[model samples]
Target: MSAFVHPDEIRSRFSAALSAMYRAEVPQYGELLALVSEVNSRVLKADPTGAERLAAAGELARLSEERHGAIRVGTADELATIARAFAVMGMAPVSYYNLAPAGVPVHSTAFRPVEPAALARNPFRVFCSLLRLELIEDEALRAEAAAALARRDIFTPCARTLIETAETAGGLDEDQADRFVSELLETFRWHAQATVSAQTYERLVAAHRLIADVVSFKGPHINHLTPRTLDIDAAQAAMPERGITPKETIEGPPARACPILLRQTSFKALEEAIAFPSGDAVVAGVHTARFGEIEQRGCALTPTGRALYDTALATRDFAALPDDWTALRRNGLAWFRYRATPQGLAARAETADLEDLIALGHVVAEPITYEDFLPVSAAGIFQSNLGAEARGTAYAVDPAKADFEQALGRLVLDEMALYQAEQDASVAATLKALGLTTATA
Candidate 1:
């Protein structure tokens, strides 16, 4: 075995550090966290079965450990470097998302741990987006934007060095990992100085607020850091009381007894003062980018479930989905991880019918949590933070995954396929433990 800090441990440390930094930078974030924790406690208290189920499924311990931060880079080089940096933390790019059709000029991917054990340790994710300069309508502005992006290197020199060391020599020793995280944090740290002139910054903002946010900044400061909540609706209702101005509406699926996919809501982005270079004098300007978000995730859905989900979203009819979990399982619309219970371990089973085993209290199936983001919900959050001017010209409805993968230096893992594999493996393992040979799914 290699003598080095485990990636999961490194990831957990970094996640804690990052959250602390954000909490310090944005005080409201701490309030939101408190609100979420309070809401979760209430929900668990009200629903003892849910609390027990979550504890059994290993979700309760990691609730406070969950965090997803978002950042927007101005170029391809930044994307590749960030991917390598995330690799040190055991995060892999999962799924490509194109927000162009939603009028946001960026394509993105979520960098997160994939394995169940690794995720259970700390499911930290960074939703990284690369600015699509090609989508810029004005050729001259696009060229200028590209030039500004090319001039800046988001990764610190030491950070780059550590990434190389980890890649070439297997892994980073404890000291190297510590230094690596400290150096890499610079890339995501907030910068108050603009790379471009005041005039350029205003012009970019006029063209698209998101574009300006990406091109004007020295580095891609994490725009927002989200804390997971067990009850988002309660948290949303509670934000205003904390002096937090939430967006008008929540994004993603409407309320459901058994929530599916992701539901998100956020407070508005703050306008921070920034200095821009203008010849011999510095010009002062304000930028709106970073915000706070709270998300509640549900079970990962199958392809058929996703299709039904898409239709329901389009039609504004959530009734298409059954709110009951058993119906959801029976319909084969959701993915669940199966485990043999204590009684099952002590008894032999003749058949592998999953429902029968579950009915007999021999097997337990827990919903697999959705670890990724929804493009539409993501775009909604971006636009809400960007204000009325967020939407750009309607770009292609299709995703440019090829361009994203090329910049990432690797193909993104399919979220659905990962869920499918996890579910299948769990079922197999559960059946084997019960001494059943027949396939249940």
Candidate 2:
């Protein structure tokens, strides 16, 4: 019997391989990585305490290795198959996002590790979107796009075999895991040769650039792979200096002393030469889609906290409302992980009063990092890179979670519920470690 390879190990290997492949495919992404590293290093040096805090939280070790990529699939079969492939890496579809409301004709779900320990080990995620062909106003174009998608199979035969093998055996051994990574990497690899003709590609582009992107490609090539940054503001400021033109405005909330949710910024998508089928000759055309993005993650908010955040965000001035960690916790605005202090662990007192413990410095509370994406932020990234056509009124379809889930073949795990569970589990474990029971204390 071979040793069972842990899913986290597999995921780490796959993420590293994917990053290397993407770096080669998009050289700008490699430059972006270097820029982010410089900024992160500077931030750590300037704020030694911040570095220590991240180290204590187990976030520092994974900071340089963290990456989240996005891809757009054209059909339900492609979506379902990719979901299975991601499952082999211990990732599940987590939250449904309807980009239609934001003028993009697609719905998305972020596939990621659900468990806290798994996430801490390797927080690799993929924001996978499935195109909504029904959203095309032109019936003829929609049908044509559907036909184009129907003719293609994104996954390779070997990839499908490996996914099934892993499923049947409960886990992949070392060799199988390496082969699986290599096979699956092909699905996201960029192909400059379009599967559709130039005329067909133009027709799909007329409907929407994103539609063309999804339907015309050989596979769902990774549109962008974002690396996490400690100070996105600094990175954003330094983008132009590094020869990278960033988008006009950062996607999420403005700079805050205590960052709330996730803030993101990205460079403009590059226009690349692609070959399209045209009779006996292949026609070359320009396509813009892939880009480099950076993110700064903040504390996960509770339901009440998220309500407050939504209310504040509704004003369209996310940065205006300044709230610190203390205020956020007092107002029930964020989820936090609790840990017993050395004093508390030594005393082992039975106390039910959390406030007292916190006030006495017997229990330390730290914000749980938000491990997900924001719908509005996601839409902003898509719209910014998709050119002016994606911003037009024609693509504004209603939000449809049910249809998205139907295509996914499974319901997405509620993001808030996951956060709440993490918060509760941490609190419970902290209390138990301190020799206190919730029933008595």
Local accuracy by lDDT, each model: 0.90, 0.88
lDDT for position 303 in model 1: 92
In order of listing, the candidates' clash counts read 0, 2
Model 1 off-target regions past 4 Å?
Answer: 391-393
| TM-scores of all predicted structures | 0.98, 0.97
lDDT of 2 by residue, 1-441 (tens): 888789899999999999999999989889899999999999999999989988888889889989999999999999999999999999999998888877888899999999989998999999999998888888888888899899999999999999999999998999999999999999999999998998888888877888899999889999999999989998999999989999988987777888878999999999999999888999999898999999999988888877767877888655534478777776677888888889988885756677788877788778889989998899889989988556664444567888888888899999999988887898899888887778222
**Candidate 1, clashing residue pairs?**
none
Model 2: colliding residue pairs: 305-333, 352-441
Among all windows of 10 consecutive residues in model 2, the one with the lowest summed lDDT is 388-397
* Highest-scoring model, lDDT: 1
lDDT for model 1, please. 0.90
Q: Which ranges in model 2 have alpha carbons more than 4 Å from their true place?
A: 317-322, 394-396, 439-441
- Global lDDT of model 2: 0.88
